[model samples]
Structures are given as structure tokens and as C-alpha cells.
Target: MKQPNEKPTLKTIAQVTGLAAATVSRALNDAADISASTKERVRLAARQVGYRPNRAGLRLRTGKTRVVALVLNIEDEILGIVSPLLSGVAEVLEASEYNLVVIPETPAGDPLKPVMDVINNGMADGIILTRTQPYDLRVKVLTDRDFPFVTYGRTDMKIKHPYIDFDNEAFAYESVRRLAALGRRNLALLAPPPHLMFHRHMSDGFRRGIRDFDCMEMPLGDIDLDTPLQEVFNRGRKHFLSTHRADGIVAGSASASVALLAGLEQAGATIQADFDMVAKEPARFTEWIRPEIIAINEDIRGSGIALARTVLSIAAGHPLQSLQQVLFPSD
Candidate 1:
């Protein structure tokens, strides 16, 4: 009998099940050649002994890490979207033997270094990429290497890699249509960074909504979603000081919307009285802070889970074509 405090291993399971260590390992891994009865016996013994696979040993034997690398933006983490996204990915990984490793990178810094590191070092079995551009070099490199990766955002590269993207076009159109229904003719859009594919989608939707609604564009100055929160606040402080006015505003994120609202309130501008704002609610906190501002839900967590599942399937030798998913926003 094993000591009560002793950690369980394949040898321990084999000792308990009266099987060879190799057979126990093959059964634990679900090897095709292993018989069902033997596998069930080994698994039952492993469960009884609380046996767990050692990742290092597994990698040495199979040349696979059983890990997934998640590449997220620093800004997204600062804005509080990282927790739920990570939770969702970890939720899926918990069910399997895989683990999650998040690698945060600056928007302006080299995003390809971590990816290349993973490829050269065999650091992970799969990867999750984000901040996808229309002509993304990262996507091109990964596709060229025939790596197992899935982007949380869409890309327009000729290669067909796996992806799970939000419906930015639909979000923009719905925001505009909702604001228009509220009788706001002059509108402005707080867009995501211009270099991303989602920005182009939003721009297309914004133009279409403007033309369809016969409304005038109230352009917000040089800043975008990537700008610092303080700067967005500073801009809002002086936004209403001038004669300019946008009766309705649509911001890309809850953080940006709140920053704008905070500065506007500090500058003595009132919500609903001065202007109405609509923003994407990935975390569902905008209404809690300010009920007057309209909030729309974005499925950030679901996107994370979808990306994980797709990449895991691809790494397991499944095709990527059937795994592409695009989530549409509701409310």
C-alpha cells in the first residue's frame, strides 16, 4: 500500500492495478492499441490512487507540451477584460490536460517575438492570438509554419486560419440605429485603433448607418480606443467647453465611455441632459456606475472559450474551416 502522504504516479497506479507501468501509461493516455478493459482498470486504479500525469514527463515522451499560449494586449488587461477572458479559457482547459499561459504585449511593441519564441522553443501545443490586423504578419507567419493557432479577432490575410471574432459591424450599426431612434441626428463614434481589422469593420458600419439614417457625422478629434484613459478624460473636459456638440456619442468600450463621462461630469456636463452615450459592456459595469448611459453586452468570455476550443481541436489534427465563429452582440 502507498503511504498516505505520498504523491501518486503511474508506478503507483500500476502497483495497485497489477499492470505494467508502460501499460498503465498507455491506458491513461487513451492509446488506440490499449484494450478497453485494461484502460478502464488502469483509469479506475489511477482514480483510486489520485494519480496525475507529470507534464514534464509527458512532453519528454510525446514531444508535446499540452499547453496553450494566450497573447493578449496590455491595454485590454488594464481595462479589466483580461480576468473574464482568462477565466473562460481556463474553464475549458480545466476539463482537459491542457494549461493556459498568457503572454501580454504592448500594442506598439513587437507582437511576433513571443509567437516565434513559442515556435522555436516548442513552448506550447497551441496558441491564441489577438489584435488581428487586415494584413497581419503574425497570422502569416503562423500559417506559414503550419502551427496550431486561433485568433480571437478576425484577419483578412489570404490564408484561412482559425478565428473567433466579434461582430463589430453589427455593434456599430446597432448603436447608431438605437441612437437614431432616440431622435439624435448629430452623432460621433469613438472607434478602436485604426490599424486593426475591427476598426475597418466599424468604419464601414458607421458610414452605412450614417447614410441609412440621414444623420450628420460629429467627428471626435484625434484620439481612439488605444489612447490613455487620462487623455480621453482630458479631451472630454474640454469637449463641451467649446461651441461644439454631439447630441449622441458611441464609444468602443466601457472604460472609455466611463472616462469620457467622468471628465464630462467634472466639466459640468450632464448625462441625458447634455448628451447620451452608448458603449460596449464587456464586463457589464457601465450601467451600475451610470444608469443614464446605454450599455450593450459583448460576449468577451464566450469569445475566449471559442478560441480555446478551436485551437485545441486544430492541435488535435482537426480542420480549422468548420471552427470559425463570429459572435453577434445582444442588447
Candidate 2:
């Protein structure tokens, strides 16, 4: 038995229960092979000794961490979207002692390197990746090493994987359609920087929307979202004023919608009259203003719950039946 007021550990339980440390560990995990009587004895002894498994030690024995890594291949400033991503994962992890470690993506770095560094160096038990490309080599890297991971987008090569992504094409198309419905034509899209899978998806969707709604499209104004909002607004105001004049505008992201509006306001433009604006993601700023903005249902909370389920499922040794692509459709 453990001495009163002493912190309980696996070793303490092993000694007090007269069982091997491995057996104590197995019992604590509720391994099916352990005899029922032995399991009961180990449990009682663990309670008396106040023993708890050493997470580090257990991982050493089983080669698992129960800790998931959220890997990004972008700068920290772009983490506004990534923050909500983690928020979804955290909601599920809060139910248990499981934890999330966020690793920021470096600018122009090798896509597979950060995660390989984390996994090979033993920093995380599993991984969650975002902004995956259509023919991304990162998927191959993870699979080659037998690392359990899930992604936030899809791939085209013949390999199967787990992922979660929004219907970017549909959402973008819908944004334009909504603007057209308001009888405003000459729609333009302010999209994220090039080279991201979501950017491609957004562009495709925006085009489809134009084709579907028979709307006239303007120049694609791509912006570096990593820059500060004030900077984006200043630049966007100049660009919007000098470049193609648009009667209807759609901001690809929630914050971008706000930034674009600031720029438009600075230029002495009124919304719903001079131009119609819709945010791709529902932004709080859209509220408390005239002409309520239309937005997509980017449920950060649902994302959290989905990530929790994916991590726990992988940890439990169950292959996700198929790559889970749960889309929270925006209205």
C-alpha cells in the first residue's frame, strides 16, 4: 500500500500488489487478457496505493502519447482560422486529460518537415494537418512512417486518408448567387493568397457561382491574409478604388469582410446601396449594422468535436472507415 499523503504511481501499485509493472500497466488500461480476479486485485491495490499510470512511462511501454499535434504550414498571424480549428479540437479534449500541441507552419519551409520533426522526435502521439494540397506529399510521409494522422482537406492521388473540409466551391458560388439575387451585378471576390488548396477550392466555387448565376465577374483580388487588417484595408481601399470597380463584393473570410468594409467605408462608400457585401464566414461585425451580411456556417465547435472523435478513434486502433469529410454548409 502507498504511504498516506504520498503521490501514487505505477511502480507503487506494482510493489504493493505484488504484480509486475507491466501487469499493473495492463490492468490499468483494462486489457482484456488480464484475469478478472487479478484485474480486481490490481484495481483495489491501486486505489489503496493511490497509484496513477505515468503517462510518459506508459507511452514508453506502449509507444503512444494520447497527445495529438495540430500542425500548420503557415505563419502564426494566419492562425485566426487555425485558432478556431484548435478550439474545436480542445472542446473534445476537455472531456478527458488528452491535450493538443499546436505547431506553427514556417514560411516557405518543407511541407513534410515540421510534422516529421515532431513525430520522429517524439513530440506528439498523433497529428492533425490543415491546408493539405491535392497531390500533397505530406500524406505519403505520414503513411510511410506509420504515423496516425488526419487532415482538413482532400488529396487526388489514389491514397485514402482521414480529413475534414468545407464545401468551398459551393460556398463561394453561393456567395455570388446571393449577391446576384439582390439585383447587384459586377461581383468581385477577395480571396486568400495563392497556393493553398482552399484557395483553389474557393476560386473554383466562385467561378461556378458566376456561371450558375450568369453574373459578370471582375478581377480576382488575392490578398496576403497574414498581414495586419489595417494594412490590408489601406491596400484594399487603394486597390478597390483604382482597380476594377465592383458593385457587389464578397470577402472570402470573416475577418477579411470586416477589413474590406473598413476600406470601403474609408472611401466614402455605403453598403447595400453603393455595393452589396457578403462574408463567407459569419462575422460578429456584420451584425449591429445595416444590410445584414450573408455567411457560411463555419462551425468551429463542430470542428472541435470532430477532431476529438478522430484522435480518440485512431488511438483506439480503429481505422476510420473512410476519410471523414463533414461539411457544415453555410446558409
Candidate 3:
């Protein structure tokens, strides 16, 4: 009988099963050399003794920490979409022994430093990066080191890396096309920050929409992503008062849409009447304020799951294709 206060180890299980410690270890790990009968007996003995493998011992033996790191910028966290993304990652990892670690980056600090520390210090086996730029330095660093990593957005660089991104360009073009169909001749786009890679894609689509639909883009349509909510409203108000007031508007994000709504209300403009508006947002947010507004749902949770799976597969030496995926919203 095992003592209540005594913790069970390989030696304990071996003693209980009358087997050598090496044999017990091999059976527990399902080594091909261990026969089926012996493996079953060892497993039964381990269960009876309530034996569990020590994580530290396993790591020392396998040279794997079984931990993954997610590096995110403070700006992206402030957008309030990180929760769902994290939920998705957690859901996929819950069934496995691996754990998740988050490293935050400041606006002024070097974003690659945290990732490098995680790799050099053996803190994590894999990494997931968010808020990728067009010419991302982190990509080159990780690639050169042969470290396993996946990105949340695409980089403009020629190097092939695994990434999961929402189809922002297609969403923007479709939004403009819809507005044109409503007989809107002059359109405005409240674009994201200039530094983000997605900004370029959205801008390209907006410009294309203008030319294809024979519509004009408002001079004051482009708004920065970091602009405060009230400031966005103020800008919208001022734009409405201008001689070049737009007949339709497309907002970059849900928060921006809220501000635009406030401004429109103040300007005595009605939705689908004075002007039509379309916003790119999560499904829940669109549902919360629907009918009056049109929305393009961006599935961030799904993106998180894809990113987690890709990084884990890469870390495990799986020959996965350099995945570059872009998800589009439903019509």
C-alpha cells in the first residue's frame, strides 16, 4: 500500500509493479520495445498508485518546455478584440499539454526583443505574432534563427511565412460597391492607421472602388485609427458641414462606426436616408446595432485558432506549407 503523504514517481510505480525503473519509464512513454502486456500492467500499476509524470523531468528529458508565446502590441490590445482571439487559442490548446504566454510591446520599444528573449531563454517552443507591418523585421529574425512562428497578418516582404489574415481589401471594395448601388455618388472611407500593413490593402481597394463605380472619394474621408472616439465624431461633424460632405461612409472599425453614428446624429443625418454607412466589425457588435447599419463581420476568433494550429505544427517539425490565408465576411 502506498503512503498517503508520499508522492508517486517512476521508482514508486516500478516498486509496485515489480518492474525495473527503466522498463516502467519505457512502458509509460509507449516505447516500441515495450510489449503490450507489460505496458498494460505498468499503466494499471501507475493508475493504482496515482502516479503522474513531473513536468520538469519531462522537459529536461525531451528539451521541450511545451509552451507557446504570443507577442502583441499594446495598440492592438486597446482595440478590445483580443479577448475573443485569446478564447479561440485557449480552446484549441486546452486538450494538449502546451501552455500559452503573452508578451506585450510598447509603442516605442523594440517588438522583436520579447520574442528573441522567449526563444534564447528557452521560455517557449513556438511563437505567434500580431500587428505585423509591411516590412516586418521580426519575420526575418525568426526565419534566420529557424524558430517556429506564425503571424496574424501578412508582411509585404518576399519571404514566405505562415500567416492568417482577414480580407480587408475585399471587404472595403464590397462596402463601397454596396454604397454605390444605393445611388451614393460621393463616398468617404475612415481608414485605419497608416503604419499597419492592412491599411495599404484597404486603401487600394477603396481607390479601386472609386474608379470602378465612377464615384468620388471625399477629401476628408481618411481618418487615423488612433484618433479618439470623440475626436472622430468631431471630425465627422466637421466633414458633414463641409461643402464636400459625402453621401455615404465606410468605417474601418466598429469603434469608428460608433463615433461616426454620433456625428451623424448631431448633423441631423439619418441612416439609409441622409447617408448610408457600412462598418467592419465582429459579428456580435454588428448584431447589437443592426438594421440601421450595415456591417462586414471579421472572424478574429477563427484567425486565432488557425494561427495557434500553424505554429504548433511548425514547432513539431511538420512540413507544413507556408500558409497565407485571408478570410472574407459573408454577404
Candidate 4:
């Protein structure tokens, strides 16, 4: 009895399920008073009628936007985080009532601007941010506001909030160990930006490994993972031209890794023949790009899933203590 041109609403779902409009609304919202059977029935009717909630109306009633914002540092395509991370976040969000919103912070401006914009505009109920600093202002601001947020990297801020961090320490330490075993005495790390929290972690591990494994440190000058690939390649080319440069390098990011390798090859240094490169595999390209490179896989997809889940849970008033996780890099 419904026109094909008509759109589906709560009333349409209620009619299909033979329930009151109020009951359908409560059930759709998963209110505690609603029975599970009734909720399931309402959901089934919603599916059958192709019903979708109006975001504006839902916000007015629940005082929640039911949106989570992902704040990313828009560096070069070097890290290759956008696609895999989004895929993982989207997979989790598809099962929930919330929606995903990406807020890109360009390298030019104040890093806190995107986060502040989300807060000021009430654009999202929660936030998930990446590229943390040792003394992160963003973490401090979010904590001070009592706003729900989850970081993809850890911070040195005194106020602890929810976070899921990749273990850069282990990644550096392990790469150094492997390279040392292969008799590579001089090593260098293409670290994250010196300002980032993980840079300290990675450098600490690199230094520790050098001391423990008796390897000499070959420092790369003023270059980092966040640097543009073209720049990285240029620096790498110049660096490798010197005969006394590092025999082993811990590659920083995926795109940067490729650039460095190309630079090394262009400088007439054979990869794994004259020197070796290691990386944290943001993607599986390490296997094909250079089979010899020891690219320890970092689960970017899994990190996305964890970040999304933690942010939503915290926004729902969950405590922060149990939500923190640090994932290790592995093959």
C-alpha cells in the first residue's frame, strides 16, 4: 500500500512492525526499557522498509551527533595510512549507529586546529587522532574539556586518556638486532619527526640496540618520515653518495622507503648487496618492492578498528583505564 516514490521513516517502520511510533523510536535507539525481541522486530522492519534516521532529528532528541572524527596529519602520501585506516574504521562503524568523519590537518597550520574545530562546531561526539607529540597540546586540550578522544599514538602528557599505540620501540630495536646479525656495523634510522612522541621511543630503541649489539650509529641529518618523498629521495641520494654512510637503514614510512631505495639504487649502491634497509610494513609492498628488506608488518587496519572502538566506547561514558593498548610490530 506504499508508493515506490515514498521515502521510509520511523512511521513507515512502525507501520510495517505494527508498533507505536514512540515504541519504534525507543527500540531504534536501543533504549533499555525496550525488550530485545521488540528491538529486533523494529530493526527488521526498519531494514525491510529501508528506514534511515534523520541526523538532525536524532541530534535534537539525544543531544548526540553520533559521529566520530578522525584527525590526521596530512603529510605526504608517504605513510599510506588513509586507505587502510579508513577501511578498518569503516568496517567497525558500519555495525554501529555512528558515522565516520575525517578531519585533515595540513602540515602548515597549528596541529590543534582540526581538533578544536570539531569541538567548537559540535561536529562529532568523539575524536580519534594520530601523530602524537611527546608533550601533546591536543591531548591536554581534549582532557581539559572532558571531551572524549582516543589517540593512535601515546603521549607524555601527565593526564592519561584512552589511546592505542604502535610499538615503535620494538620495531626499531628488532630491526637493529636483525641488521647487526647480518654484520652491518653502521646503522641509521629514518625516524618520525623529532617532535612526535614515537620518535623518542624509536630513537631510544635504536640507541639501545646500537649499544647492546655493538653497532655504530650513522645519523641522517634533518630528515624524517614526514618529509616529502622527493626531498627524502634527494637527501638519500646525496647521503648514499658518501662511501662512509650507513650500511643499514631503518626505513621510516612506506612511500619514503621506496624513495630511499630508489635513491640508494640511483647512487649505484645495490640494495642488500652493499647495504640493507628495514621498515615497518604499513602495506605489503615490502615483499615485492625488495624481497630482501625486513619489513615488519604493522597492522594499520587493526589499529583503525581499535581506535574507532575505543573512541566510541569512551564517548558512551566508558572509563579510560581499560581501553589503552599498545600493539607490537611483527612479520
Best by lDDT: 4
The residue-by-residue lDDT of candidate 1 on 121-203, one tens digit each, is 88899999988899999998988888989998888878877788889898888888988898887888989899999999888
lDDT of 4 at 38: 91
Model 4 agreement with the true structure over 143-238: per-residue lDDT tens digits: 999999989999887887789998999999999999999999899999987888999999999999999999999977788877778888888888
Off by over 4 Å in 2: 1-53, 73-79, 220-228, 282-285, 288-291
Clashing pairs in 1: none
Over 268-318, each residue of candidate 3 has an lDDT whose tens digit, in order, gives: 777788888888886566556555678788887888888888888888786
- Among residues 3 or more apart in sequence or in different chains, the pairs in candidate 3 whose N, CA or C atoms overlap within 3 Å are none
Give the Cα error of residue 176 in candidate 2, in Å. Answer: 1.0
lDDT of each: 0.84, 0.72, 0.81, 0.85
User: Over the stretch 1-331, how does candidate 2's per-residue lDDT look in tens digits?
Assistant: 5567878877788888889988987876657798878877887786665555566876888776657788864454431465667677887765433567888776577778878888778877778887777788888888888787888776666777777777777777788888999997788887766666777878898888888788888763446544457776886577557657788887777776777777877887777777888776533435545345666656655665676678667766766765577585655
Poorest 10 consecutive residues of model 1 by lDDT? 74-83
Clashing residue pairs in candidate 2 are 88-304, 89-304, 169-205, 297-330
TM-scores of all predicted structures: 0.90, 0.81, 0.81, 0.93
Would you give me the overall lDDT of model 4?
Answer: 0.85
Q: If ranked by TM-score, best first, what sequence of candidates would result?
A: 4, 1, 3, 2
Residue 14 in candidate 4, Cα distance off native in Å: 3.6
Report each candidate's C-alpha RMSD, comma-separated, in the order given. Answer: 2.9, 4.7, 4.9, 2.2
Candidate 3: stretches off by over 4 Å:
1-58, 74-79
- How much does candidate 4 score in TM-score? 0.93
